[model samples]
Target: MPKLKVKKSAKKRYKLIGEKKFIRRKAFKGHLLEKKSPKQKRNLGNKVVVSYSDTKAIRKMLIC
Candidate 1:
């Protein structure tokens, strides 16, 4: 049988921590920042954990 390879796109976007948890960058930080409030833009700079419902699926893709 062929070895299962982790998805390359997923590998680049998400990171595995310890065993079960994954960390990902927050959304909406990529564009249109000029009109957004400073606080909102600032908050987008932080990383956020993937939600609980998505955790299992993301872990499979991340392979960490």
Candidate 2:
């Protein structure tokens, strides 16, 4: 059988942690930051775990 190729886009955007958990950056921080509150900007800078609904698809892109 041929080896499966990992999705480059997913590889850059999502990170694999341990087994099935994936971490990703929050959006809305890339632009228009001047108007956003400092609290909001600080919160957006953090990495968040991928939602359960999206975990399966992300796993396929990353490992399948």
Candidate 3:
């Protein structure tokens, strides 16, 4: 059987913290930062765990 290929994009964007648990950068921090409050900007900088609803698809792509 052929080896299963992982999604390169997913590999780059998401990180494995543990089995079945993935972390990713939060959105809305890349642009328009000047208009957003400092608190909001600070909060956006942290990595967040993937939601349970979407975890399966991401795990499939990541081959976890």
Candidate 4:
């Protein structure tokens, strides 16, 4: 069989944690930060696990 290539976009977006779980950056912090509160910006800076509903699809993209 041919080598399974990983999706470049997924590689840049998601990070593999352990076995199956993946972590990603929170959204809405990309721009227009002036109106956002400190607390909101702080929370958005942290990485969050991908939603359970999307786990399977992410794994496939990662070729895990």
Judging by lDDT against the true structure, name the best candidate. Answer: 4
Scanning candidate 2 in windows of ten residues, the lowest lDDT window is 55-64
Q: Across residues 8-44, which tens digit of lDDT does each residue of candidate 3 receive?
A: 9999999888777789999999998999999999999
| Structural similarity to truth (TM-score) of each candidate | 0.85, 0.87, 0.87, 0.87
Clashes of each: 0, 0, 0, 0
Task: Summarize candidate 2's per-residue lDDT along 3-63 as a digit string, tens digits.
Answer: 9999999999998888778899999999999999999999999999998899999988878
Question: In lDDT terms, how accurate is model 2?
Answer: 0.92
Q: Which residue pairs overlap in candidate 3's backbone?
A: none
10-44: candidate 4 lDDT, tens digit per residue = 99999989877889999999999999999999999
Q: Comparing candidate 1 with candidate 3, which one achieves the higher lDDT?
A: 3
lDDT tens digits, residue span 1-64, model 1: 9878898998888887766678899989999999999999999999887777888898777554
How does model 4 fare in lDDT? 0.93
- Candidates 1 and 2 compared by TM-score, better number: 2
Q: Can you list the residue pairs that collide in candidate 2?
A: none
Error of 1 at 44 (Å): 0.4
Candidate order, TM-score descending:
2, 4, 3, 1
User: What lDDT, from 0 to 1, does candidate 3 have?
Assistant: 0.91
- Candidate-wise lDDT, in order: 0.84, 0.92, 0.91, 0.93
Which candidate, 1 or 4, has the higher lDDT? 4
Worst 10 residues of 4 by lDDT: 13-22
